[model samples]
Target: MTWKDKLGLVHIYTGNGKGKTTAAFGLAVRMLGSGGKVAIVQFMKAPKAYGEQKKIEECGALIESFGLPKFVHGKPTEEDIEAAKRALARAKELASSGEWDLVIVDEVCVALGFNMLDVGEVRELIKSKAPHTELVLTGRYCPEELFELADYVTEMREIKHPYQRGVIARRGVEY
Candidate 1:
């Protein structure tokens, strides 16, 4: 029996800070190192040049992006909502496929917070996940209800950040 046969749990990473995606990616790396297949579904984040994305691909993991070209701040456009829905649907498909050992839903909370997706849909997706597939959800503004559904939840609190000092995100560091 493989390690995948012995484990499958829901993990949530959320808060008004950094490291949510980083933490999830770290876990993905660990899983990949253990001979497990990993799939990442990014919501609300468009396809772009990201260091981790390249590394994850090189590590033999799949990464799918469902987002617009720019970030949604004030109000999300119809295209944004459609993209988020597609992301959620793809996440559900991957989580239930039983082919992947781990499935990471990146920026899902942000999509939910932007009203592009529904909490119930996410809950259903979690509930319907394959028994042998571990799931990870990451993003800011996580709903309280999700805490009750998740097996483990980590909240990243931002005490300080370089963005606060007018420093823009650097390449390969904060992409």
Candidate 2:
């Protein structure tokens, strides 16, 4: 009944463009629709800020987000660092528990880029995941070394974005 043997693979969605989280959530939807379990640990994003959080949960996926209301820029504050660490710990536990078919660590690369998280910890989390768990990592500035460790590494290079025209993030599109 368990598809554990077939589910162990690492996916990385990174780069400056959009759709990294979208891709991850898309996979989450597929998994859940197919009677698979999923868990998402979001780093550097507040739980209530995103529209997907509520809807994804309604679709039977567990989501936990860690971050302050304010976005971290340049150097992160202690609160940001602590939140990232908490998210990291939860990600490790869920990824290794073998309870979910899909495990996503969202925005973790941003945490790494901002120095809120160390690549070593993320490296270890990937290494320690359950054998049957499918892992997804999302965000910009993903460490090149991690790409080498992934089974599917997708870089969403910005071809064009509405941000260039000064359009801000809109609900249901960019969230």
Candidate 3:
């Protein structure tokens, strides 16, 4: 309801590399293992194709996806923007409800980087989150403001990625 009621845990995973989403999902699974309620807010992807999304669904956590499908480097359309806004609203409600122990915002920084949402709005949502909530945010090129607000930050620096060799993403590995 107010900033004083907000949580203390936050993490940011960023950089031009793989495993940001995977790492966050791992944390979510770990929290679930400990009998914690969880929610995942997916940005720039859907629930249909991702392995992690499917796994979380079967595990019974609340998982929601937003953003439209676009090929790499494609610009977002207006519909995609609206979906992102809707997803943010849903995430805010969940975060403020004090229902989830862990909440992951996958690829949120990428959405902000594309100007789909404002950093201030996201910061406000984080500020309004419930006490004891753990927010995990993942994406490349995270804004410094988000980083400054984070209690922990991890950057997945790309050393060698198969994408450079034209390797398609393998299910269970990338997705």
Model 3: lDDT of residue 7? 48
How high a TM-score does candidate 1 get?
A: 0.97
TM-scores across all candidates? 0.97, 0.96, 0.91
Taken over the whole model, the C-alpha lDDT of each candidate is 0.92, 0.92, 0.83
Q: Indicate which candidate wins on lDDT.
A: 2
Q: Candidate 3 — number of clashing residue pairs?
A: 0
Query: What are the clashing pairs of model 3?
Result: none
Better of 1 and 3 by lDDT: 1
Give me the displacement of residue 158 in model 3, in angstroms.
0.5
Model 1 residue runs over 4 Å out of place are none
**Cα-based lDDT at residue 56, candidate 3:** 87
Poorly placed runs, candidate 2 (over 4 Å): 1-4
| lDDT value, residue 87 of candidate 2 | 95
